[model samples]
Target: MWQPFEYAPKNKIIFGKNSLARLGEITEQFTVKRVAIVTDQGIIDTGHVEKAAYYLTQKNITTYTFSDFAQNPTTENVTAGVDFAKEHQIELIIGLGGGSSMDCAKGVNFLLTNGGEMQDYWGYGKAKQKMLPMIGIPTTTGTGSEAQSYALISDSKTHRKMACGDPKASFRVAILDPSLTVTQPTSVMKATGIDAISHAIESAVTKRRNALSASFSLYAWKLLNANFESMLFSPENEEANMGMQMGACYSGMAIENSMLGATHACANPLTKNYGITHGHAIALMLPHVIRYNADHAQDIYEDLCRISGIVIASCAGKALARRIEKIVAATELPTTLSAYGITADAINNLAVEANEEWTAQFNPRIVKYNDFVSLYNKAL
Candidate 1:
């Protein structure tokens, strides 16, 4: 039986090498005046901010820069950004880095235009006012925030990640320039690449998965699996870089159509409790979650394994789990929670937090706190 679904595609994506050239024209289409570019200090240090600013300068567009958000942005960060944008009377926004920068831009947009606390808009489509138009240029291939309507912000008070979303929050345009990603250091590359791969894998069997969304995840899997190694081992491989970016973007699209699963559900508690980088936390937990889901979701996993041209070792679900662990290890990222010094005592608390995360509800299989506890122990 076919499941009912809804699809509303909102993003206009411009992809290629040096696609950043179109920023001025895109902003002109929106009649942008003064603009704010939201990103991190790393991007400015790497000269991407200057490069983007130069393009705006060519068209006589004035700009403000905000790089004040954390890796997992906080409500305070968005509040500060909204104040900055308001003080400057910025007319348009550009997010010019990884997920953090893009998400921060969306966070700012919510409070700047809508005039409310971040908590007021914690779920989907809560904004009742017009949103300032924004463009997202991903300097790294992770997070896929550019392609989705949700902003993952952390509550400064609770330290819990919040999924604040609205149609208005989705980027007006997403610029995927492969050249921009090639300059990232190996650590950034590995971490973000794993995140993209996880999106491709996890979104495939979520309860919300539909045929259209599944197509995106499956193709994303093929691209990421095929290109990930080349992008890592062969520095500046333009073709490989393009594949990874496209894969990540498609995976983002899948996330928009469906949602993530228990891997993310299990991953979040690690980040919340241990201050682990989101990517590494996800990498540590995903293999175990994959194995856990496979008891019911094996066909989906095997299909992806086959489509990605990976050998399903002995035609068993456990092989797929081991393969995921191998990929994480090959990236040289930690594959165990213990690597980060998280002790057994942490599992009980982490599982409780995981149980509360909304993404766990979307897992293809039913997940409970006990299931999270088991998954965390296996990850350890």
Candidate 2:
């Protein structure tokens, strides 16, 4: 029997090679005068923010810049953005960067509208007031934050990243311009590209997955899994970059409909403890998680192997895991916990946190603290 499911979509997406050119026109759709451009210094330094600002400026729109957020946006970051928005009396916002910039934009929306802090809206559907209409302009092919409603803001004291979300907080429009991603550094491409792949694989077998979410996941898998090798070497290829952007965004849609699983559950603990990048953390543990979830999700794994043309090395799950491990290696990222300098003694502590993560509950195979402990050991 099929489980009953519901899908809710809020954002209107505009995707193409030069979608950023329509920024000014998109802003005109909403009745707003002052607009806040929420981004990070890295994006500003790249001149992408200025390029986006030009479009709005041409339409005689006043724009205020707020670029104080970190790569992993924190409560403090969102708070500062709220202050900026309040001071500027921003009637709208434009998120023009990668996941960090877009996530901060959603975070800013949470507090600016609801009269509370980021931590207050930590769960889901917590907003009460209508948020400022905003446009998302993603400059990378990772995280797919543009396609989702949740803002992953880190707690100031505990450092636990909160998935703060509300339908109102979702971007009114997402403009995916592949040309913007061409400027991304090779390291950024690897981290974000792998993150998309993780989303593709994890969403397919998650307990909350439905037909809609599975289709998005498989489509994402097909786009990204097939191009990993070529994209790594030909990062500047226009077609490959376009496919990766769509792949990441499609996986984000899957996450929007369903949710992630143990790889995310394990990765969060690694990020909090080791200060490792989120993509690197997940890439290290995802292969191990595939093996962990394999017995229960064999059909799902086999489906990915078939659709993505992954060669099976005797076992559906193990083969998929091995294939992914090789792909991660192509990025030259650290794939083992030991390589990251994490000690054997820390597995218990890490497992405790991993087990407590909300995503852990959705793992197709029930995840216990011991399972996490063992998985971390294998990654080591």
Predicted candidate 2 versus true structure: per-residue lDDT over 1-380, tens digit per residue:
48789887889999998888999888987967799998878788888888888998888889999998888988998899999999999999888888999999999888888887787898899898888898888888889889899899899889998998888988989999999888888999999999999999999999999999999999999999877667789978988998999999999999998899999999999999899999899899999999998999999899999998887877899999998899998999988899889999999999999999999999999999999999999999
What lDDT does each candidate get?
0.89, 0.90
Error of 1 at 338 (Å): 1.4
lDDT per residue as tens, model 1, 16-102: 899998788788888777999999998899888998988888888998999988989999999999999989999999999999999
Task: Give the distance in Å from residue 369's predicted Cα in candidate 1 to where it truly belongs.
Answer: 0.9
- 55 in model 1: Cα distance from truth in Å? 1.1
Q: lDDT (0-100) at residue 283 of candidate 1?
A: 87
What's the CA error at residue 46 for candidate 1, in Å?
1.4
Poorest stretch of ten by lDDT in candidate 1:
308-317
- Deviating ranges (above 4 Å) for candidate 1: 313-316
